[model samples]
Target: MRTAVVSPKGDSKFLLQMRRGGLVKVYDSCLMAGSLYKSLLVSERTTAEEVVQLVLHCYNSSDRGSKYSLYEVCPIKSYERALHSNELPLRIQQNWPSPEHFCLPPQTESGGHT
Candidate 1:
């Protein structure tokens, strides 16, 4: 397998995350948190960078995690890049698109079964 090796101690400026159905938290030396936040931003109607900063600030100031800095197993820059690309995950994409596009009735209607 391939691997990356840094100095005695690698960069520790990225370590926050929001798990599925779980609260968001920061890590000790993780950077992928930014990516997750970016994904979230894309899902919403907000800018990716704005969302990333909001999440990072929240994790830093909030008492959510165990206080270990919430290091990420991935890099935040990568996450940001992904978000900038406008390539959100399939789950998030589902939230978009009107029901009519899929042949579903409007919410006010009976929502007829297939």
Candidate 2:
């Protein structure tokens, strides 16, 4: 797959949204049954930390980006793993046999989904 770089220094256009199940929601976005997954267009070099920033950007959240955590979730395999701060999501995502998504929860590091 062709890779593209993403950065906070870049504009909002570089920021992508991933809506999987109930983990994320775009404010004022209309509900649609087939809109479960929206592709995230970050490069393989993009770190989990950067992805967190993107998620925060999506929510217009005022909280520190450090307060959130990103996880690679695969409902088909019935598995979810917390990604390291420096990990690359695109790399993990490429390994997915089927559609998967990153989970950004405030307390995932502490075993809390909320």
Candidate 3:
């Protein structure tokens, strides 16, 4: 499996070639069904974290014969930096709620009631 970065300008493209009929299909963004490009070209402004998540989603969803060529839209280095950096925005981290937030409330004298 291979990963490609979606350009910051959102100008990346994807090219897929069929194994059986020797047909080549081109895509601009994720407009086609079952296309990885769709995963990358998310609605709203694309973020590095979103890109990574989409790429992983696509990779996991693909069958054995799925293969594609990603046109570099965002540089791979930028994605790497975003991934490694500890300064991600709070909104992005909010996707994974903190474990503390799921903790049960303290038990009252009634055992279950507050």
Please give the distance, in angstroms, between residue 63's alpha carbon in candidate 3 and its true position after superposition: 17
lDDT of 3 by residue, 1-114 (tens): 235544455676765432221111112223234442221223323333433344446547452212222221123233211232222222243343442222111111232311
- Model 3: which residue pairs collide? 6-74, 7-73, 7-74, 30-37, 30-38
Better model by TM-score: candidate 1 vs candidate 2: 2
lDDT tens string, model 1, 49-110? 33334444644645322222211122323221133322223233345353112211011113
lDDT of each: 0.29, 0.54, 0.29
lDDT of 2 by residue, 13-85 (tens): 3644442311231111111233343334676677778777776575566767677677666556677677788
What is the model-wide C-alpha lDDT for candidate 2?
0.54
Question: What's the TM-score of each model vs. the native?
Answer: 0.23, 0.56, 0.21
Give the winner by lDDT. Answer: 2
The regions of model 3 sitting more than 4 angstroms off are 1-39, 61-114
Model 1 worst lDDT window (10 residues): 99-108
* Candidate 1 vs candidate 2, lDDT winner: 2
